[model samples]
Target: MSGVPTGSSGDLENKDILSYVALGDSFTEGMSDPYPDSDSVPNGRYRGWADRVAEHLADHVSEVRYANLAVRGRLIAQIRDEQVPRAVEMSPDLITLCAGGNDIIRPGSDPDKVVEIFESMIAELRSTGARVVIFTGFDTNWQPVMRHLRGKIATYNMHMRSVADRYGCDVVDVWSMRILDDQRAWNWDRLHLSSEGHRRLALRVCEVLDLPVDDDWNRPWPPPEPRGWRSARQEDLHWAREFLVPWIGRRLTGRSSGDGVSPKRPELQRCERYRPGD
Candidate 1:
């Protein structure tokens, strides 16, 4: 990998990854970012960064099989139990895992404990002789409520780096991506990335894979519109009511946004440009 730090044992000598399996939570599942001309997909399917990256890979190679086994509101344990084993069975040449964010943001959750589970998943994936990549928690300092969880996120990110090093895995360091600091990079809910944000992330992931991309993920944004104190507070209240409260309620009720959701592309298929209906 050119820009991404790698472990001693795993290296991508060939950029031509034949098969890729994406495993993780909402971020990997593509929350908030909708498909073109559709607010939602056939079955809550989201064309997230992982899908975009798969499409990019398909662009260069003759064929690349891909599957995204991610669902929203999944805890670290759920991912480890449900996704990791399936990925290993698929035996893909490349895998990208971004778990534990849901667990980390919860009250009283331990980053050390989360990483322990995370490391186990990576160890199992590496056992299949597959190249693995992991994503770090994003720096959430840009949002007021999310900023409160920054310490926990930072702690988890540190452990993630160490685990990647030990496993010889590649890393997508979202914590250091300053481009996401802009508000436009996030969806209106302020929880997941916007379409533009996902696009940028796709570019970053390609770069990490040593894949050629025409766009720059680090491009600067125009100046943000200045908001008065009262306006800012009103917006915050709206966000809380619209997004934060529902999220908290789900946690309290032990319900998930993905309670009955199934993985969009559960089976490995030839990567193709995501059309509106597909």
Candidate 2:
């Protein structure tokens, strides 16, 4: 969609938006899609949920300057080190965070650490006087594997809820909203979301951002079915057993590991170099 429609009947007009920042991992970066033109590199510009959110905001709000600093395969530490600093520097009026999935998938990483990082991030965001939005949910394909880590997810979400309550920020319950036991909402990799999944997520984010949802926005633009679906049960389990499990084992055992894995990229021309003063 081009821009998000405000629920109002007026023509699309820019509002006096100060600024907004989006920070997180692959999910926030829209890992599966091709990156936008503005990115410094192909990988740098994946059109994830952050892009969707920004587009929607642009349609309805006239005066917003939105910057998405999300990266694929970013863990909590990586976000803290890279994304958060840039976001804080922007001094945004609004901020959205969608992360922790990679951390959960990482070997040897404690789920508690995820919660701790989220809490710290929220605290820091609040200190900046920005209205914060936190997204909570996981793709259905990962649910089975996440079952072991469900408790940790719950705890992390609970912590987020408490922080939001204390700080008067918005919390989007995306997890309960999008995940359904009967349907598959993930891609073949069983990690990234399907296009339909991204649309669903974008709509929910629109709601949280208080943007208007049009018929097009709610119509499931990509259509979930006819694309064919996979039963999470029928998928290969060897990857989890051979790759993920062992990787996590090594992480827990204090072996140095790189960021979990790079995501698949669409073929595209490399963008111009990102210069601070370009």
Candidate 3:
């Protein structure tokens, strides 16, 4: 849908999404998707869909202001109480909010409660008069261990469609993006998207926003090499060591990946990566 509602000038196409604010958890913070000069991942410099979406807009419009307040490992409540107020203060022209993933995964958390709180937060953002871009949780049918949360994720996504419609917001429908279903689209951790996943997510956001972009999020991936049972088992063990362990540790200790981190770009500016040449 065009960013702006039916208008005399139809300006959503021509007008720049001058001010953009992204608020959520690691998904919005761009985890596992490192930037060229990425710092201690917690420093939050990873360039994910929000940043890429901003750059796409900056390319078309004269200027665009963007800020990302997302922090990895944050629950839905923290995002609502902390990031939402800051985002509303910014009064961005465009806002992308993708939280609740953290909550849905917690052992005892209720997906419905998470969505309830999440929608309320979105309403608060909508009150700012900014066009909100929402996302349904991705399908994780490929990840065996993560399958337990699949039902919860699906529940959240199902409610999300109606919630987005109620808010007049754009839904990116990550669940329906078949391209992301590919194993290559995900990082080794299987919990977060890889760089390619982020790129595709950026494309999907541009599509929803009705912006001009050349890339296709649905482009096919090359054939994969066959893996024997032993190697597959080894890969699973390594994944548990590298990603799952730390994730569970964080949940147990009450520490966060973004505990002391700040947004890479607190204010909007031209995305240098998009500029001509390095």
Q: Please list the C-alpha lDDT of all candidates, in the order they appear.
A: 0.86, 0.61, 0.79
Model 1 TM-score on a 0 to 1 scale: 0.91
Superposed model 3: Cα runs more than 4 Å off: 1-11, 37-42, 270-278
Candidate 1 per-residue lDDT over residues 89-118, each given as its tens digit: 898988999999999999999999999999
For model 3, the local distance difference test gives: 0.79
| Tens-digit per-residue lDDT, 207-269, candidate 3 | 888887787788889888988999989998999999789978988898877777766666655
Better of 1 and 2 by TM-score: 1
lDDT of 1: 0.86
Pairs with steric clashes in candidate 1: 7-168
**All candidates: TM-score:** 0.91, 0.70, 0.90
Candidate 2, run of 10 with poorest lDDT: 1-10
Residues 1-278, candidate 2: write the lDDT tens digits. 11322122222233455466778777776756544344543535456556666666666665556676666657788888777776777777778887777676555667666777877776677677677888775534345655676666666667667766766667888657634332444555556776556656777777766678773433433445553335433445655775567656766786533354342221111122222211
Clashing pairs for model 3 are: 66-268
Distance from true location, Cα of 86 in model 2, Å: 1.7
lDDT of 3 at 59: 75
What is the RMSD, in Å, between candidate 2 and the native fold over all Cα?
Answer: 8.7
The stretch of ten residues in a row with the least summed lDDT in candidate 1 is 1-10
The top-ranked prediction according to lDDT is: 1
Shift of residue 43 alpha carbon in model 2, Å: 3.8
Residue 95's lDDT in candidate 3: 85
How well does candidate 2 score on lDDT at residue 55? 66
